[model samples]
Target: MKLVSLNIGKPAELSYKKKTVLSGIKKRPVQTSLYLSNIGFIGDGQADLIHHGGEDKAVCVYALEHYAYWEETFNRPLPPAAFGENVTAAGVLETDVHVGDVFQLGESIVQISQPRQPCFKLAALHHEPKLALLVEETGYTGFYFRVLTEGKVKITSELKRTEIHPAKITISKANTIMNNKNADREDVHMLSQLEELAESWKKPLRIRLQ
Candidate 1:
């Protein structure tokens, strides 16, 4: 799919909260962006600055098809995103991705390091109170990456799948299945499937789920 637009936010607020003691609370949504300043490779935490990969961590340039979308369902403004994403994407599915997959953003190439798991900081911002729990239910929340190659990327740049290892799982299936299953069970079987697929790939595949 073509990259419709590129969006970057700087120094946006992040927070967390819980509505009722028993209910699954919404992750407080706020504006945030991926920083070119602090990024890390696999196993790096977003909070730690020293360990980050510098601009090498391409947290800022995201595919719009997957992470960011226009909410026609709401005349109201979309709630702020709890976890700040560097790239607001459209068609790129997160779970389907794996290490070694190369996402071509114009001339720049980015490698998938790991999934962007949710943190408490997101919930406190919007006052949703239980955001982390809600995100647990919705895997579409987005992720992080390290820039294998760096260059200027802007809105309307096409996102091409250049390389993907066979050992990777498409996050799209997992995310969709999670939405279908009842929320009561704490099932993460999708994660197992992802890991399984990740092991099967010899080389990375460059295909986005249409």
Candidate 2:
């Protein structure tokens, strides 16, 4: 797949529900190459570390294809990195990506960790209180990556698949189980056992399966 854009942003304050809040969800595309470390992109910032910006959820990746659907649904021209993804990719969707899939991105290596669980920050960033819910319902939520080998990454870099996990559970499947309370118990159990699945995601499933 192609790495369409590399985006980064610093923490900024925004008005949400008549209250000022600090967030780093509004990312802007960067023209130059950037370093990808264990923490995340060199210039990227995440205001809330509790739900984001950990070693397990380092690089957020969103599909460029989903932008069209969102734009049409909202009737607004969304900009690149609208979802606050560090990498905006094309030619790859959730259905095509699985947890544990390894790829060589630029000079670094990364592995798919988990599907992005949308939070209210998305709503605040988009100025639509229901946008976060809409993203979850649409199942277009992007995924995250954990850097396996730190190196430089640029917008011009290509995503070359190096390995695919034996479990082969697609990101879409994982999202369904995570968001759907009535999802099959067997599937939840299976996903929980996946070693590559992020603990943040597995914790809930484990609780549900209990």
Identify the leading candidate in terms of TM-score. 2
In candidate 2, position 50 carries an lDDT of 89
* TM agreement with the true structure for every prediction: 0.56, 0.98
RMSD of each: 9.6, 0.9
Runs in model 1 with CA error above 4 Å? Answer: 12-57, 60-76, 79-83, 172-210
* Candidate 1: 10-residue stretch with minimal lDDT: 201-210
Candidate 2 stretches greater than 4 Å from native:
none
Residue 195's lDDT in candidate 2: 96
C-alpha lDDT (0 to 100) for residue 78 of candidate 2? 91
Worst 10 residues of 2 by lDDT: 14-23
- lDDT string for model 1 (1-210, tens) is 565433433333343332322111222222332222324212223443432225434463334443233233222344433244545555666655654577776556676654444545555544555765666565655545567665555545667778876755454444443445442222344344343223212112211111
Name the TM-score of candidate 1: 0.56
